[model samples]
Target chain A: MGIALILVSTLAAGVPLRLDLVLPDHARRGKAVPITLRLSNPGPEPATVYLQGRPTAFDIVITRADGTPVWRRLDRAVISSILQVRVLPPGQAIEFTERWSQQDDRGQAVPVGEYRVTGVLPTDPPSELRTQTVRLRILP
Target chain B: MRTPTPVQALAAGTLILAAACSDGNEPTAPSNETPSAAMQGANQGAPDDPIALARGVPGFGGFYLDAAGKPVVYLKSAAHRARAEQALTPFLRSQGLAPSQLRVLPGRYDWTQLEDWFSRASAGVLAIPGAVFVDANEASNRVTIGVQQGSFARIRGIVERLGIPPEAIEFQETMPVRLLATLRGRVRPVVGGLQINFPGFLCTLGFNAVRNGQRSFITNSHCTNHQGGVESTPYYQPSQNIAPARVATEVSDPVYSQSKTGCPPGYRCRFSDASRAAYTSATTSTLGRIAKTAGPNNGSITISGNFNVTAEGSASVGQVVGKVGRTTGWTAGKVTNTCVNVAVSGTNLGQLCQTLVSARSGAGDSGAPVFKGSSNVTLVGILWGGIVNPNGSSTTFVYSPMANIERELGALTTF
Candidate 1:
């Protein structure tokens, strides 16, 4: 198994951005909210990360502390996100830019307390080995 | 003038065993001492030494009886051989066997002729009688012999036709050799990290070696441009597919899909309790004990307690028990009644059964070690088959005989 490293040299204006989980720091059950992740690459090489799904090709996931999946979307949406970041190089970094709303097919918000996010990424230098788990959490 | 001497008697007995038990053609046993031997005994050297050339030839085939009387087979080969050195290479290198160890017929088209060239190879020799194809015209040509593993047993038919004495040929067993050259210092892949052998996927499987200093074990023929490496799955896949989805996709609806496949060729799926937890309790207890036992046997660290086994065991069915595996460990089992057939594979291969005192074979256990428990645990079978795919409904089981596997393994690892 490989490990992915994140180096944050500068942030909002040169202040290194902190990589942490953001969510219902404390929220009511059944409330739809978004989680944000801070990103940085302090090394000379850019990093390309992929959010690998669970069990199958179509299931990218970020589960709650209790093991319940917090990210909800049709299979198509997951595939779309995958195709979006198909390419990324070293030394480059993306911010807490992407937004995702949590809700079920019935449009009902998911019951949650704490959540985690995980996926896959290529960590080898000079090699673009793909597919990995990216794990993170949201405190609501 | 005299009864057969002790040496002659021994040679004859060896010939009989080889001829009667071989999975190949039967050859007439030669005299204990060749005609040349008599001349050498008389004059110390002979001019018409047919036995010299015949003995010089190598004997190549798979699945032979080793010195220990256990079946063995060689899993390695060499590309070059000198005519003079070919005859005695196998014996000298692996098992320290000699020309007298095997008996080949004299007249052309005899086992002696084939053995002349294949027998000697320090690296290893896979002895399987070359298949003989006899056309309508009765012109016989050599066809290839196919055994689950390369062994003499697979060539029994060929040996019989070539008139090769069976006793002379023996099986070799491979000692576990080191195979971690490529894996030694290479960067370890994360659970989902993917990297091409960007350099080269020589070989990744590692084993302990005896003779040669630990070296990477790679087969020339099994290599392709980009096909090499290890995967997270239980089955032994080519090197190219080691990553997660980028390589192998989980069988869709693994449970349902595997279950449907378990049904008969044309039958409907039937989810039965027999396929579920009938022996779960027994299995849990058995595995718990076995996992502790594995430490002494060099098993992987994490032996799962939740592995599956069959529930249907009958009394004295002489079931050829073993595991179908990628990691290549197999054992023998007996039919214990009051048992049920567990879903060994994902499909309808219900032949895989669970035993109480046996071993716990898991994912990599496809070829786990199995042995008979009737008396003491004697190595009796090889695990070769089971449902590759399994469904909650029904799983299939497939197995190869331990005798066959042992026979082949014997030939390869004798040294």
Candidate 2:
């Protein structure tokens, strides 16, 4: 450990970090879609937050309008056992971007359809944090 | 652990993927680390200086600098004045002083006696949770025990049972101190004070080293899946998914000792909170170098790898020290107490003979390297835990001393 500055925010100060998913509204079939997750500390005070892993630490799901699952990231992938925690200063943000290759978990190209992408951050207590869902449309 | 459940169409688990780890926080510049004038002439006597220069003249008393920075050597009797002046000559002249400027006074107790009481009372007092520190207060001629607010009675009872006379001991209430481990970002050919990840947790890598022709790095044993077990748990830089490859594996993590030799009541003891991970190739590691952050408060940019560690030694009380971690880049403070037996709350662990520093530390700073020089460094210890502020940062922290590190991990050539 070299140097660290913990803003030392209280739990009453709310969650120390904020999380969100960033993706395009639509992508053409067979083309890779970039999935970005941003974790930031918007501080009036310092906060301690955790992310299980980078992109792998989150469960990114793409489902149809009818709630039928289209594809899932980490659906059967081995989640690395390591956990990461950061007591971040306010205004500090870390972003992770991964490519979703338009294919389903089974390696099949998805048919053009309306879809929604959501992310979940699972912590040790088993209380999972879910991001607001974003809509996506796959083109033929 | 963000793993997945395949049965559910929308998995509710975690996965490990590599992401470019970056720190968005600004860091504070660390103060230069040098012996404070008040702490000069410590036990490390130059061949020319008397061994008791600052620690006091044993039966006479101790030495200190007055408000104007002049040397003050206190004694128990006017008869010792000549000896005190003679002992302070070379050190005084070196500071551009004549023996005429030396101040002498009759002190209440011999420093040697107070130091003995401190040593005798530390482990037992620290065994009580909330007993933050045990210090030898030179000016007060008493052994000071800093107890957290609610822990006073518990600490007082233990100290009383240890047979220290009430007049010779002092108590002060303190705030909560938390264990700290911190760091972030992926740096190739990793260095100390960077983020290293293990299953279910993350911590800072202390230093890169070599043992028996293999490269290795040290981190807090608590960062491992098991604190003192050779589980061979793999480690990753910054985060595991970045390359999905481990930087090293736990090779040695000494079991907590069952014997109570250094332990207080009801605790298993370990000399250091350290664990070593073996690197398979020399190409993936470097030795004696810590990840250098931009000078103080600017630790967000860690590309420079020039902070050099030239030697390993014990940190004396009152010396300044610094550390780097993934979370808080660079923070520095003074070494307040030495050889304190620290108990980690919520665990059965008692770290014996640890050093305490008042610095800015936070979660994820575990295993951070602590050095004593500002321009360069003399490696002293590794960050393990601290008393955290309400905001989650540490104002006073604890680390395993170099001697203790070697006690359990064997002799190491850590420059």
Candidate 3:
């Protein structure tokens, strides 16, 4: 009876939060392609979402289909890396979006292939962390 | 490995030689850029006194000396007291109005007649009537009259007696002329009783202007016949006229074909395209002589670029236009009014699609392509004259509409 109560309480307090990774599915070679992230806050109260970046987290990595990484270190990116956004008020839902491009970093040619991207989000305790992943294809 | 033979080296070189030699000898010039070759001699150091040059260039179009020695350009002639008196004498006497109420305005009339009347009035004339509205066709073969400021009823009665269509009359009391003494040189005669042969005339065999299956090569009526041999306006001597000319490859001249010395400081001489071709097929041609000759006689010939004789595109107010002329080169302008009745001088009469005032054209700007943009500058109108004044400062030109020109030219023959 105690185990059932605990399970019921956990289900009642749990939040149904969903994060969707948005990006261009395909892009021509040698073009500055954009990648977007969709942060959906599905709750009655507003939620503050933070994108955490390292003190020197100015690097972008493009990987080949075989999982070998092709990365470029950026000297100075144009826009702020961390996007702090507020959710919509009340039951109204809102989408938070941010875009980055290959032109932001100096890199080698992105050969035609399918690849995956990942970003890490940090929470207050430092121990609790959230991660996001996206899949995209580069066109010739 | 054995050393390669000389023949083997030659065979390797053949691969490099195998590539196509397609790039032409010359490249295209920038659209708005004047050539550098002519620039060296075009700009002379400024004169000590700019007014000296103005005085040197003989005042031609709408110019006169003012009291301060500075030349004032008037877009219209100063009121001609005598001409006004002549035009108003009948009206004033008939109206039984006193001389004080009916003032004789001095110096103000169309440039066509103003030049003659102004010279005559300057010699001796107490005061000529202003805006007597004479049916004067002078200078650039323009139909101009004067205006009178009085009671609206009196002005109406005078205007009625002048017999000018209400639309043709402008009530602007003041006409503008060139502010400086500028020389308008000799007005190039459109037809010097000579012929022009386009050895490289581009042919649009009347295909574009016809109904289903009808064929004619688009060509100019002026192109139909001209003077003999090289003694012609364009000085081109063609062996014969081909019914249909094939498309010739485009050609541009980088070097001046013939150097002309002593061109005025601001002017430069450039070579004109003298290309030609022959057509083997027929199509409905839309090009024709839109107006009579530039002279008093209606015998002037027209030069044409290849155009499809398709139906004229829609006419609109405030649209852009372009034209290719035999003398004035290529120019562009805009449409001002439509179906305007202009008193065309000489034997030709009636209204034309009136073009707005564009300075890009002049007397010989006749028969040039007057169309919007790159589309076949469908021959739209004939440029007769501009809003001219006696003092020669600001003259805005007007053109006959293209529809009227096309209707008058009859069938559009395309090559």
Top candidate when judged by TM-score against the true structure: 2
Runs off by more than 4 Å, candidate 1 = A1-64, A75-98, A102-105, A109-113, A120-140, B1-93, B96-104, B109-415
- For model 2, the DockQ equals 0.05
Interface RMSDs of all predictions?
15.2, 13.6, 35.0
Over 4 Å off, model 3: A1-140, B1-311, B345-357, B375-398, B411-415
User: Which 10-residue window of candidate 1 chain B scores lowest in summed lDDT?
Assistant: B273-282
TM-scores for all candidates: the values are 0.24, 0.44, 0.23
lDDT against true structure, model 1: 0.27
Of 2 and 3, which scores higher on lDDT? 2
lDDT of 2 by residue, B167-233 (tens): 5666665654533322466676777888887875777889887777668998888878787889998
DockQ of each candidate relative to the true complex: 0.02, 0.05, 0.00
Better candidate by TM-score, 2 or 3: 2
Query: Which candidate number maximizes DockQ?
Result: 2
Candidate 1 lDDT for residue A90? 39
Please tell me the TM-score of chain A for candidate 2. 0.80
Candidate 3 residue-wise lDDT, B1-415, digit = tens? 0111111112222112211211221212212223243332332323332221211121212222234432222222222222222222333444453222322111223344433543432232213344333322222112223333332234434554544434332232222221221011111121111122333221111112321343222222222222111222221211124222222111111222123342223333221111112222331112232211222112223322233323345346677654443333344555656654333221122222345535343332322334444433344444433332222121244554545434433434322
- Candidate 3 overall Cα lDDT vs. reference? 0.31
Task: For model 3 chain B, give the 10-residue run with minimal summed lDDT.
Answer: B181-190
lDDT of 1 by residue, B99-147 (tens): 3334322221323333342333111223333222211100111112212
Rank by TM-score, highest first: 2, 1, 3
